[model samples]
Target: MIGKTFSHYKILEKLGEGGMGVVYLAEDSKLERKVAIKFLPRHFATHSDEWERFKIEAKAAAALNHPNIATIHAIEEVNDEIFIVMEYIDGQELKEKISKGPITIEESIKIAIQITEGLNAAHEKDIVHRDIKSSNIMITEKGKVKIMDFGLAKIRGGVQLTKEQSALGTAAYMSPEQARGEPTDHGADIWAFG
Candidate 1:
């Protein structure tokens, strides 16, 4: 990936790569602050569906200003790349922590509690997080839990999934309803918790 400035943000360091794109821990020169920038991979850059969903993710994520949600500052298109500028959290991804090992039952429950609260808020607005897992949960330095990747989120009356009996969610975290490709509602999240 290129390490060029997007508007006022100066790419500081490559954070980590994901299936969709490369993430960078950047510095917002204008604001003199830090932010995380996620770039849309070139292959998907021209996909209208992904682009549209990215917009929806921006709107959905920006809607919730809660402490448990990653704060989205702006979503922009620089040249041929799409990037989302989010609050730069100085902490490890929950999955990274889990990778070092599993958490205690009590700690796991606490983390789940915070996530459930955020999910409930989004669900109340009819937003479904199609992808939810330990990897997408960000733990801030101050012990705050923030959910990420509302990118795959489905909104009410939103786009339809393809019909090949295909599943479009994180395999491990997917609820049975989602896994089975059945119609689902808020209950799906509860099932995911199981």
Candidate 2:
């Protein structure tokens, strides 16, 4: 999609891809700012269930306004191509940092605190980010932590999105209850933090 114009945004380069969507770096000509746009994979876009989940992810994240959580600018569909425009985070994923080597205790503590703060904000809004693994966490170049991807988030007392008895998050980081496919709340996030 490089060089293609989706609305007023011109795609510059591909950022990354995951199970849920493919992210791209784009230039928002209207706002004159760099933004990251996540598009539902072509295959998934045709599936109503996946489309609903993608919309939910946008709604869940767009509702938050926190420094430690990536900001959602807008969710748009152009000619049936659905995508979400969000703040472009120029940094590496926490998973990449950890893969290089172990970080100092102090650095670890700082990251943990930021993640906790972000999670706190989400919980306060009754949003449970089911996927809280390292890859889902971005550490900006300036040492700011921003949580990304609320694809599996469950908004408490909201519509039921997932199938019963089916696990939704990363296996290694899931809380016992989450792994068991049981009902969860903010406690699941706290458990992942540990």
Candidate 3:
């Protein structure tokens, strides 16, 4: 995708890949800003259910605005290629920090507080972030925490999106109720936070 122009955005380089799709660093020529674009995999795009969920992810996160949360810029489809444009965050995944070594108590407390604050904002909007693992949390170079990937989030009062007991979150961070394949709520996030 390098050098390819999707809409007004020019693909620059690859950021990473996940189960949902590959993320790339792109330049928004219209706005003259760098953005992160996550493209839905062609295989998954062919699947209707996953496609729907992909759209839902954009909606679910687009409604939220918090410093501790990554911002959603736009969801676009160019030539059957669906992608999400998001705030380009230059940071390291929280999981990597932990793996490198133990963090200072002060830094740990700050990160926890930021995560809690971000979750509080989501819960206030009746959104339940079903996944809250370390990898899903980002620590910016300036020491700011930003929660990302609301792809598995469940909006309260919305239609059930996933199968019961399918365990959408990482096993180590999943709540017990989620593990049992039962319905969950904000409490599940709190459990993961603990």
Candidate 4:
């Protein structure tokens, strides 16, 4: 999809790819700004359940507005392809930072505070971020934190997405209850954060 225009976004180059979708750096023609476009893989897009979950991820995250959280500008479909337009963050993933070397206590505390605030915002909205790990958190050039990937989030009072005894998320970060395949709440995020 490189060099192609979807809606008003002109794809410049691919930024990265993950299990959920491929993200691209694009230019917004109408707004004259840069943005990231995450497109659902064609193979997975054909699956109704997965497609619905992708849409849900957009909806869940779009409802939240916080400086510590990545902003979802739009969820669009072009030629039957679904994609999400999000704020382009210029920084490294927290995972990379942690892997490079040990972070100072002060830096760690700063990051922890940002993460907690971000999580607090989500939890206050009754949205549980089931997947909370270093890889899903970004540290911007200005040292600001932005929590991303709401694909595995569970909206409180919404339909139960996972079956009973079905565990989801990175095994290493999974809470005891999550690892045990039990229902989890916001507390699961706390476990992962620790």
lDDT values for all models: 0.78, 0.92, 0.90, 0.90
How many steric clashes does model 2 contain? 0
Put down candidate 2 lDDT per residue, 91-136, tens digits, no spaces: 9999999999999999999999999999999999999998898998
Better of 2 and 3 by lDDT: 2
Instruction: Tell me each candidate's TM-score.
Output: 0.87, 0.95, 0.95, 0.94
Pairwise TM-score winner, candidates 1 and 4: 4
After TM-score superposition, what is the CA distance of residue 81 in candidate 3 from its true location, in Å?
A: 0.4
| lDDT score for residue 87 of model 3 | 96
Ranking by TM-score: 2, 3, 4, 1
**What is candidate 4's TM-score against the reference?**
0.94
Give candidate 3's whole-model lDDT.
0.90
Clashes of each: 0, 0, 1, 0
Can you write out model 1's per-residue Cα lDDT over 1-194, one digit (the tens) per residue? 44678899888899877655678999899999999998888777778766776777788788877777788999998877789899887888898988998779988888888998888888878877777777788887666898886766677666663344767677787888788886566666666655
Per-residue lDDT value at 177 in model 4: 92
Q: What local lDDT does model 1 show for residue 68?
A: 76
The candidate 4 region of ten consecutive residues with least summed lDDT is: 156-165
List pairs with backbone clashes in candidate 4. none
